[model samples]
Target: MLDPDLAFGEPVDDFSHCGTGECRVNTLPVLYRLNQVISESSGLADALRIILDIMRVSLRMDRGIITLYDRRSDTIFIHESFGLTDEERKRGIYAPGEGITGKVVESGQAIVVPRLSESADFLNRTGSPESERRAKAAFICVPIMLGKKVLGTIAGERVYRSRLLLKQDAEFIAAIALMIAPLAELYLIANVEKVALETENLRLRNELKERYQPANIIGNSKPMQEVYELIRKVSTSRATVLILGESGVGKELVAGAIHYSSAASEGPFVKFNCAAIPENLAESGLFGHEKGAFTGALAAHKGSFEQADGGTIFLDEVGELTLAVQAKLLRVLQERVIERVGGSRPLKVDVRIIAATNRDLAAMVERGEFREDLYYRLYVVPITVPPLRDRGSDVILLTDHFVAQSSRANHKSIKRISTPALNMLMAYHWPGNVRELENVIERAVILSDDDVIHGYNLPPSLQTSDETGTTFGVSLESKIHAVEYEMIVEALKSSNGNVGLAANELGLTRRMLGLRMERYGISYKTFRTGTPPRR
Candidate 1:
């Protein structure tokens, strides 16, 4: 007897010796074919197509159908079928316990009919054929059971004259259904995970696209405006760009702006830090290697150049590359091709190069440390990112941008910076540049207790001394006034003692400037060549 959860517990007398006949030979080969087909298939639809085709040819089963329960719609719909017209497949849907297929799925058991036409529960939903050949066939419907739950049903029809017994055929189909149950469940789960990952990837790409826009660089200073113009000019061509700047002055940010705003923005943007790789493996890291290229090389690998094909490759600290690697890189820049570490064939690539370095490549070339040929090739388009000190008032703009970012990230309620804190930030000489400014602001945001970022929350280095090496160790209010006084004095001198011009340059009204000057006992004429008479 079959298991109680799988079928009715009754044995037919005539079919008791059916397995001894042709059943064992035919059923064993069909199971082997099912395994072979399922292993080669990558999708559930293809696997089911092969499984049903094997049943039709080897077991003489036709009109095969597989239906899975749709939990969302609360119905069983045909997922795969063989020997059915297109119109018939479209009409194959049943609610639980509504028809023979639905009944099997609902009952968690099997149903077998010796003559499909004689069974009152058989609903021939498939379109009519010329010979009415399906009406005279025997039918078998089996629930695909796992433990106690019925996941789906598999059913098929065979002509009555076949040598296979109905009971033997029913058991064979049920065993195959049991084998396919786990595989179908796994396929469904994998598909869901793949969709989720794709959605997340698209979101990240959009974020990168927006973050690298020229308007998003956060500066209105003349130096920054020049950098923006250079970015626009260089983005129109495919020439190699060499970015010169101190460390942490946003060289990578400039690289991203060039790539995403260029014609090749739709293509990939691959980044590699030349200083991060080991000297011995630098060649393999830049140019991919074939399988068994070295001790641990088990498979073919694509290096940065190949990965960045049809796009741009940003090599940070390109000055650190050894002479041997530099010689190979020169070949790539000259011919747009690369040879794998262990392979003889040279593969052509269409990558645009954007290399950045803090060191002077000209000096390196003079010393013969860096190849002169590569230096000229990369120097075709050069853009220098100005350090933090050169961009006078951009520090306050950057500080506010970072404060807002850190507020949202850390879930703080910081809204504005106190005047004293802003004064200190503007006075410091940021050797580490914009990157360091962002770090300081993020730290201040985290440490700040009130909604406003006060002087006490800032780092000690920024607060103690000004860029001119002058120390203001007084109270916070007094230090703020001192920094204000110094800035006013410098502005007045630059304006040649014109109070109106000084006020406009300092982002202040003339009346406010005069009031502050009188309070600080500063006469505009002392530093200027000649003073304009008071209006």
Candidate 2:
């Protein structure tokens, strides 16, 4: 008889009473089936339920239950069970040291109750019937542990048998617990990461909603307002948008605005550069390929169209696609289906197409460079984004936006762009458009020494000679003289009126330096008095 106060029953460790041959015969097949079930199961919960079922069937256990400890709640609840009603399973909750199941978890040891009818520790929380409570029964429970940490417990009840048989059964249950510890731990970790990823995805979706709003696009110029109006009208529909603009003119940005503002905002927005894909792989890249379709194609792939199934796909530089690829794209536009490389079945895709190009697609079609049918299909709603040079004072607005962004990124405290720098930015013809403007601002912010972006911080390409009023075709001799004059002035300021020191700095003799200064009308006497001579 077990002690009433020690409700944990008996700890079963030595199974020597059970012969080795009997143990091997009974345990080997169970272990093999458990391995097979675990390998074939999709998730931890499913695997655990199947495992409990196996125990009930093979070990002749009347009931089996698996419980997991929730650190957040500081309690153990039935995670999986067999031969127990839903109500009974829900009643099987326990805190550490609360019941026999809890005691096994608290001590991280196996427990065997030889006779349920006599043991006072058998709580019977699941409400066993009077007849079953009076019947001969043996209960076995073992802690499921990962290393030294107890994660949960597994328990079962069988017909009361010989003590030797109960010991053998307890040993087998303990071994099963050991095998599942790693899986349970992995399931717990995966659940945590899945929750974190869901939170992050929600945050990003909200941010995109705010960021890609049509009103958020910078520029109120007449051209931009017209572009905004077009975006608003077509954003609610499923029409194919053909964005016409020079390279780096924010065509992709406009496409993004349309996507996020549309009804399909919750779906993916896939971007593919038509000119960037290699010619030989372009079809495979867009339509995907089956495993063993070609060399090095080890597994099946999902292409851009399939990936953007219920969403939008922005095909930039669409005019650069080869004729063969153009035909396939035309078929997709017409039939709404795509066939993988070396695949016969056509996979249907519901995707909104948005194509952009800097080239003249109308002329390309005439010259046989682009497909005529595809050009018409993409031209459903043509939007021409004006070049930056054409959008007058919008330059100042964009410059301020870029400055603020660059300042925060580079950890600078830039207050404003100097008047001269602003003038240069407004006056220049931006061949690279808004993209080039952003790069120039980032460069100036990194090179700036103080709170202001000066004219000198601007790239040389933006610098024009005041005398010639032009950036190009300046005389070589004039350029040399301008550079020399600045160098000599800087040298004098550094030397503080010491002619010999200034000369040494410029790697010139004192006489040569003095002669050049006289010609350039620079006087070292002014520098000696802590004043720089004007050029």
Candidate 3:
């Protein structure tokens, strides 16, 4: 019988036996057996046998049964049992809110009676006559807990009552139960995560089905969102948008969105990166190339601007276009018209222009590198996107998002990044910006052999042994020292062994550079020549 003090309501701890034999020696062996079974077993069936083996050898019970609570049916059923034939085991299963087991579950406490005949709740469906006789005999039933939840119970008849079932028996059972809780919890959590990951993957896949979907643009930063919002607003209108950002931040996606949402919603959305186009054929490509327009112009072909007539044309890296090409583009924007190369008769067509550039065209205009009038024309409704490093919190958010995404893409199941890997990601400055961050995340996800992405898998840029920030915090002297070292190095390299040249490179007079070098306690000769100065 279960000790009242060691009932299912409390964690059984105090172990003292009325008399010791099988119950005394069974605890360690039962635990070891459970470990062996769980290690060998793969699924629920194996898990049940693992538990059953514990009961058979440890408790010396005549028969043992485990019942799992069915939420939908509001009852318990036999997941599996031990010490009975397969048919008999199946027969021992009982409904919840029925029998002593059901009452124990409802009550949330272990109930053991010395005499089963006296118990009113004992609705015993005995396996056979022999089992029936055993059922009238003595037994112990304790709730199986996966943490605080009652998964079900372990119940059986004592084979031979040589010793009274004391606090020790319940303590040993609870020990096994306590150990099982964590495993069960892990199984439940892992299964839930797997399902959730799969569902998210399916949704993302469906989004990519359309020729144009917002999901194609991968960024969660506020700047990126602002770009998306602007695209969404003006997409329905005939108003043109000129995207402005560093190269590789996905400006074409914005243009695609504009086209998909505009009056020419069903029309084609063509893209042409201006910088990628050769200077010789730039105009012909913007307009159309007639047969023999150039030596390689084998046949008449429509350009991007013409192909996207009644639709939208995305002009990426527009700042790279030559002055001649810029003038033609200005004319195209001024009037919705395009002329095929060598063909006269102006081809008037309705087309929207969406332009993007990484260069500061205003500065270029000041330097006469780009046209001033064309700059004004293209600067209309400019949307500038911030670099990845500037967008705080978006880095890790996008990292997790990409990890989940790439995991599905590569048929992998990476769960998360290790702390060191995450620390590296957070600390490192992404100079290549969002595009670089995306590439790194994709690679990390692919290279992750374990569920956790470790620091070893991180790109070399993040692997700098500069753990200085963590230890030093913010020190003005350290910063100044680093800056001083950089300046000296620059001066030395630019000077090329000449002190005057080094001094001129530093924008300091030779006399001043010599004085400064002396003050810092260094000979100019030692620095220029790869030799240490005498102290």
Q: Which candidate is the best by TM-score?
A: 2
Task: Put down candidate 2 lDDT per residue, 363-388, tens digits, no spaces.
Answer: 99999999999999999999999999
Question: Model 1, 65-176: lDDT tens per residue?
Answer: 9877654445666668888865466457677887788788888889877666677987765544635666667678998776786767888887654323566667877888
**Which candidate would rank higher by TM-score, 2 or 3?**
2
Q: Quote the lDDT for 518 in model 1.
A: 95
Q: Give residue 317's lDDT in candidate 1 (0 to 100).
A: 98
Worst 10 residues of 1 by lDDT: 1-10
For model 2, how big is the CA root-mean-square deviation?
A: 17.9
Shift of residue 219 alpha carbon in model 1, Å: 0.7
How would you order the candidates by TM-score, starting with the best? Answer: 2, 1, 3
Deviating ranges (above 4 Å) for candidate 1: 1-198, 466-470, 473-535
Model 1 clashes, total count: 0
Identify the candidate with maximal lDDT. 2
What TM value does model 3 have? Answer: 0.48
| lDDT measured at residue 401 in model 2 versus the true structure, 0 to 100 | 95
Backbone clash count for every predicted candidate, in the order shown:
0, 0, 0
